[model samples]
Target: MLFNIINNVRIICAKIVQIAKSGHPGMPLGISDLFSILWFYFYKINFLNINSINKDKLIISNGHGVLIQYVLLYYSNIYNFNDIINFRKFNSKTPGHPEKNEIIDASTGPLGQGVGIGVGIGIKNKINSFIFNKKINIINNKIWIINGDGCMMEGVSYETTSLCGVYKINNIILIYDSNNISIDGLIVTYFNENIRMRFTSLNWNIIGPVSGHSYYNIFKAYKLSLKSYFPTLIIFNTIIGFISPCKSYNEVVHGSIFNKNEFNFIIKNYCIKYIFKKKILIDNKIKYFKYFIFFYKKKYFELIRILNFIIPKINYIYIYTKNRYNCINKSTRFVSSVLLKNIFILPEITGGSADLSASNLTKNDFIGFFKKKKRYRYIKYGIREFGMSVINYGINLTKTGINFCSTFLVFMSYMYSSFRNFCISKIKNIFIFTHDSFLIGEDGPSHQPVEHLKSLRIIPRIIVFRPYNFIEVIICWNIALKLKKNIVCIILSRQNFINNEIKFYNVKNIIKGGYFVLNKKKNDLIIVSCGADLEICFICSKYLNKYFLINIFSIYSSNLLNKQKKNFKNIFINKKILFIESSNDNSILKYKSLYTFILGINKFGKSSNTKELLKYYNITKKNIIKICLYIIKKKF
Candidate 1:
């Protein structure tokens, strides 16, 4: 029966390859036995209860081999075989990659994200297990991540695997499909490290280089992995395109469809003698699954509402800095620490650092370590900024109300792709980035972010708020909570300006894109700024008022100017609009011909004190005042 099932799955994989003409046919052909053992014997999944809190989660990280997963789900009576045939077709449940809503797990074709997300799920499971105890055994749900050598080669996998070891994620199992072939060529050409040894060093229990075609070895390995008290890595050594005559063990077979002769050869080698091509059975399985899904969705929504109610009742706060000055109070860090103290209600919000929690002031005082159960809130994500960002997204995707991740502003470049995708997916999360600009002295040019401000500004549908002080940081936190779109709230690590008189409006205005900050006299120049840079404009305005006798208006959001016609004209009419910012000047240039003269750091700065760096870069009050004086004098 198992052999028949495995043969059927291979045939399905071949059919999918024939249809898509562009997919990974290798792993499905090679590791069908491994999947069969997992699905039929080792794994426990209630098809009727797909979203059951205790149901084991399986993530196919090498998403190109989605046909393998599709076939298994179909044979296991979860989905129909037709869905497998419809792979890569539009509006089909089975997309080219495993999508979150479409499949049991979200897959990233970009590599590494699946493993990172799996680690986050493992962390979430552990927390849930501790919180609910016997009432709900969320930790009982194991996380199975099937990855290729390409995924393992990615740096994110290393970062996440190390963290998984540190967290002691016993319920997480990583199945490495060691086919040795990648898109370009053999993975050995580029990656020849001792993978098992590396994982062992990270404290992971290394299982096997199991025979990919053997059910016995695969089953035994899985059972051993389950019993292990640490994260497990099961390496399956197999040939690419195992049954295909011409392409077996070849790199060419990694991501292309086999020709007619090659396809026929695979069929002859793998298919049973009597079965050429079996017609899909239109059984009541789909109807039953649909009925279950309907009830599951209703239950899920009810749970969401319940969670929403519970989330607000729980006191949780996030403090962030976009400019260097806001780090002065250390109150943002203090507030975050306070939230971390209440471990029970705020268990869902996991804080992480890209190896800079101490520098970024992200380390909470009360939560010493997360090693023991229910002890800590901070997650040391190592130096993997990209992995940290994606893991934050994954944690949020788990629908646990709030999660936060942070690193130096310079490291945001490493996390840019994942962060952009997180925004596109509309994950409601917080990102705290410190050391925001050139003013971050002594770290030198490598640590400074000249274009990052402008780069982040271009991402559509995300609110990028750079608060000037601790009060604004608090207000930004309040605003960030209500935001549905992607937001990058930038806070300063230097200079504290206490704005006690400023009235914080309901954060609803932030959703509208931008709003008015100071209603100064209508003038030719509107000082447009964000983050700590806004303070420069404020200081410029004060100097201009004192000496230059020029009027300056503060525009909080440049995005708002593009939306409202009247607001744009009212803000930038017939005046020299000198924009003062500490980062790149291009952010203000988009409002072109709004009499904008952008004053900001155009290059990287050398390591020095904050004041020295600011002065050296011409970002000081004297230099800003000089610019204003020049603009006024030139106008006259």
Candidate 2:
């Protein structure tokens, strides 16, 4: 049966790649036997039971070889055979890469992220099982990943691997497809490191450099993995393109498709003789489906009961307004700490900073670090930004917790790959970034963020907010909590902010992303800004009003404002608008209204005091006043 499954997968994979005239088929050919054992025997999955929490997860970390995953899923009856023919076509669920839905949970193609994501899923289930009192029968499952040399070489893989060992994360089996080949010929040309020694150093149990095509060896190794108490790394060495007649073990076969004659010859000789005539039989699917349906119904009610204990039950108004004990003139991160305190009080919030809790203001007295203590809430991520981001997404996948992680804004670049995956997957998590803009005082250029704001804003599905005052801070917090579909990034500042006039601003109107905090009557110039720059806008608006009537608009989230209807455009369009920001002004440039001039820092900031930095970059209140006057003169 294993041999038949492997041969059928190879045939289907060959046909898909040959017809599409694209995709990497070498991995599918080399790793088919291993996938055959995984999907059929080891992985306890019910294709029809999408809601069952007991379903084991399989992540194809080397996403280029996703055709193998698709083929196995088709054989398992999760997808129709017709969908296999439309592989890589637009709008098809069987895309070149796997997307999270009923089948797979992580959309992976870029190397290393899938491995990190797999580790995240492993951690989530571990935490879940802990909450359920270690009842393996209730929510026990495994996070399995098949990664190639590319994933092993990526730094994020090493980070996740090391963390997995440090935490002693269990039930994760990473199968390394060691073909010793890459796109540029042998992997030895670039990567010759001893993987066994490396994984052993990281405390992972190493299995074998066994033959990938041997069913007995693969099954025996997997049996050993199921009994291990720690994370395991299984190594398999196989020919790059094993079954192809012409390109067998060739590097060109890593990504190239065989011609018609070559494919036809192979199919005639191997597939025609060894293929099953009928669809693969699953004698126990009906029994498993019935059991899962009963399990789902029982678990559904149990989950509802669990939610009663986990859901937040607090007066939001009292928490934000009455008990807001922090100083009125507080740093945005300090305000974030106040909100996080209330948020952490909820049972489902679990996360901490990457060693920046003190600086990022993420430390809370209400929750202890989750260091070998299952009863605690916070997880000390220890400066691993990319790993932290991926793990946050994984925790959300459990549908059990609201995950969050904080770090300095300038360091978000280290997690760009994971951030891109976060945006693409639309995984719900609260990612709080502090030290926004160049206002961190003496931290100098390396700590300052000039273009990070615009870079994050351009991501299609993400919500980027820069709160100007405590009211906006509370509003963004509420918005982030209510969101279950997309990620929300709250960019905070290191400077102090206080708006006694926060009551005068329309509190309900802040969710519209942008609103006039000080618009009284018709005016000549409209001052638009967000974050600490809104304070500058306030000062400039006051001084500019003496010369020319001006209206002040505070944009809490420019992305959300752009999403508003046409009627919303009447507020700021066609008017002489002066955009003020301490960071890059590319976000405001998207609105190409006539008579607009942006004042922002487009270069690296210096090591100076807040006042000097603002003046050096011409971002002070007086500078904004002067720029408004110049724009008004030019418009007139």
Candidate 3:
């Protein structure tokens, strides 16, 4: 039966790819044997009840070859043969690679993220079982992932591998496809590193040189993995392009489609167990493994959903009051620490920093670092930014809790690829970035973020907030919580800030994402600003108001304001708007119309005090006054 499934998958997938004229057939053929073994014997899943959390799941980390899974989906009666025929077509559920589906929890195409996502899913289950195991049987399951040689070389893979080792997350099984061939050529030419020594050193349970083709050896290896106490990495030695007549064990077959002659050879000789007489017909599919459930798990699942959130020591009234300041005039990060203390107290919110907890203001005394076998809440994600982001995406799929991670704003480049996935996948994680711009003195230009604000705002589905005051900070947090569908980023500052007047701003207006502090029936100019830059612009506006009737509009989130701009067009369109920001002005240039000028940083900042950096970058009061004059002179 397993032989029939394997051969049928190959022939069907070959035809599916042939129809598209483009699809990876080599991996589908090469990895078909192990895949068949997993579905028929090892993996415990009911395709009808795929949403159930008690069964084993297969995470295809190397999604370059996802046609194999589509074939399996067809066998289970989840997708008809026609859906398989329409693989990789627009508006079709079967995309080129694994996207978010009923079976696959997370979308994956970029290599190495699925490894981290698998670990992330395992991490949430581990934490939940640790916290609430005695309360109920809280959804225990194992995460199995397959990665090729290409995934092993990716730096994000190493980051996640190290994180998995550190956490000792034991419920994960990693299958390494040691085919030694990538798209370019044999990996031996560039990636000849020893997998055994490398993974063993990282504290993984290693089993290898197992026959990827031989069902007996693969079954024996899986049995050993089930008995292991640590996360396992099984190295399967297999042939790339396993049964293709022309390009077996060759890079050409890795991504290219088979020609007519080569495919004919396969249909005639290799497809012995199965015959392609008509369209690939799916069986009743009881052959795919199923675990018996005596009753529905909805009751036990709800037991783990604990909600014990409490208001902070600082009164909730004061947070929403007319004077929402600590009165100490502390830094925005300091202000953030107060909010994080309350947010961390919530049972479901897990967070940590990428080795910058002290600086990122993520240090929590309530729930300390999660050590091996410890019931602590904080996850010490030590310096791995990309790994942290991808793991958060995995955690999001669990649907039990929301998680967050933090780092300096400048380090966003490190995790950008994973961040893009976070937005694309619509993963909910509170991404906190401190030291928002060049304000962090002595960190040098390398640590200062000039275009980072613009970079984050431009991503399609992300909501970026750079709040300027305490009320706006609270408002951004509230707005983020309500906008659960979008991933939210809170950009913080290193400078001290206080606004007694800002606290009196209407909560209703602030909730709209951004609003004007001073607006009248008539005004000469509009000064748009946000974050630390807003404070300077506000002060400068007060002085400029004597000559020009300036209206100050503070934007908490550029994207959020963009949505509500139909009512606020008078503030920008057909008017001379002077945009002031400490970072690059490109983020605000989207509001450009009529006659507009941006008195903002366009170059990298240097190592210096905030005052000198301000002067050098022309972000000073003198510069603001000069720009305002120039804006008034410019014609519409």
Candidate 4:
């Protein structure tokens, strides 16, 4: 039966690649038996209840081998055969890489992320077990990651491996596919590291050098890993593209397409009859799996009840709003810290910064630090930006909680890949980027973000919130909570914002992404700004009040502003709009159709105070007034 399944998988891989006329066939062919053993015997999953919280996670870190996963899902009756037939087609669930909201829990394409993601899920599981009173380990599901030679080489994976060891995170099995072949011919050409020694030094229980083709060896490793008390690394020594005619075990066939003749030759080389039962019968057979069905139903209700408790009550928002109104003039991070203290009613809200908790103001006073020795809320992720980010995404996959990570805005580039993965996965996670812009004075150019806001804005489905004041922070946080699936980048200021009395401070209007602070049906000119720039706009508005009927908008999100209806967005576009921003990037230019001017710096900032930086960059009320006067004189 096992032989039959492996042979069927080989056949499926050939067919999918042949049909798509594209895709990496080597990894799927090489790792067929490993996947067969995983899904058929040990991997706990019911196709009918794929969303079961208790179901073990299977992350294909080497997503080039995604075809093997698709084939398994099809054969196991989790996905229809139609999905297989339409592999890599537009609108099909079977993309080249595994996408989230599908059978796969975490999206895996960019190598090494799945390792970090697995660690995150494992951490979440351990925390959840504590949440369930420690008596019943309801959320203890294994996070199985299948990483290839490429994944092993990636630095992100190594970082996560060390972290898992330091924290002693368990229920994580990282299977290293040591095929020893890369697109460049051989891994030994550029990569050489003692795998077992490295993992041993990192404190991971090493379980391999196992034969990939042997079911017994794989089973024994899995059994030993389950009984062990820490993260396990099972290294599988296997031949790349084994048992195929089209360049079998050849580096040249890494991502090569197979022609009909080549496909036929490969099938013939396998030389196995296709005698598996039909899909309909397979589906029916799974329904009769007594143990799987019972646990599926039990976990379904358990998750629902847990989610209900985790979701904050409506009154919390009201109370949170009231607290925001009473907030004193302070740095946005200080306000965030105060608000965090009041709004941590939900137990699932857990996270910490990369050793910038004091600066990022992410440490919730009520929630204790999440120590590895005990289950708590915050994780003191000491300076692991990349690891912290991927883990945040992983924790979100658990569906038991929401996670937020914080660091200096400039350091976002360090963890950009993880953010890209989050975008690809369409996971709802919060990222608090503090010390935004040149206003984070004296930290120098290295710590200031100039193009970072523009870079974050371009990512699809990501909401970049640059709140101007205490009220907008609350509004943006409210929106972040309500959003179903998106990455919210809350860009904040280091300097304290001037507390100007907001006219018509309706919090609901903040959802529109941009709202008029000086509500006007008709105006000679409009001043648009965001974050710390709002203070300049307020001053500029007063200076220009005698010369022109001015309208000012505190535009928090450029993406959200563009999303507004044409008539609504045109209100600002109809007038002569002057955009004021600290960064040189003219992101707000997209919203206006009229002849508009932007006041910003196109160069890096120097180490100085906020006043010096603002003046040096001409991001001042004086500059705003001069520009407005020049524009008004030219128009007249």
Misplaced by over 4 Å in model 4 are 277-310, 314-326
Q: What would the per-residue lDDT of candidate 2 be over residues 563-585, giving only the tens digit for each residue?
A: 87778755766778888777775
lDDT of 4 by residue, 217-326 (tens): 97787788787787899999888877776587789778887887887787777658776642321121334334444656655455565565345454646655576655
Error of 3 at 494 (Å): 1.6
lDDT of 1 by residue, 144-217 (tens): 88898989888888888888898888889999989888878877778998998999999999988888878778
Between candidates 1 and 4, the one scoring higher on lDDT is 4
lDDT of 3 at 239: 87
Least lDDT summed over 10 consecutive residues: which range in candidate 2?
276-285
What shift in Å separates residue 634 of candidate 3 from its native position after superposition? 4.3
lDDT measured at residue 11 in model 2 versus the true structure, 0 to 100: 83
Point out the higher-scoring one by TM-score: 1 or 3.
3
Q: Return the TM-score for each candidate structure.
A: 0.84, 0.93, 0.92, 0.92
Full-model lDDT, candidate 1: 0.67
Model 4: lDDT of residue 604: 89
Per-residue lDDT of model 3, residues 41-94, tens digit only: 677766655655556767888887888888887776778878989989997878
Could you tell me which residue pairs clash in candidate 4? 370-378
* 290 Cα displacement, candidate 2 (Å): 14
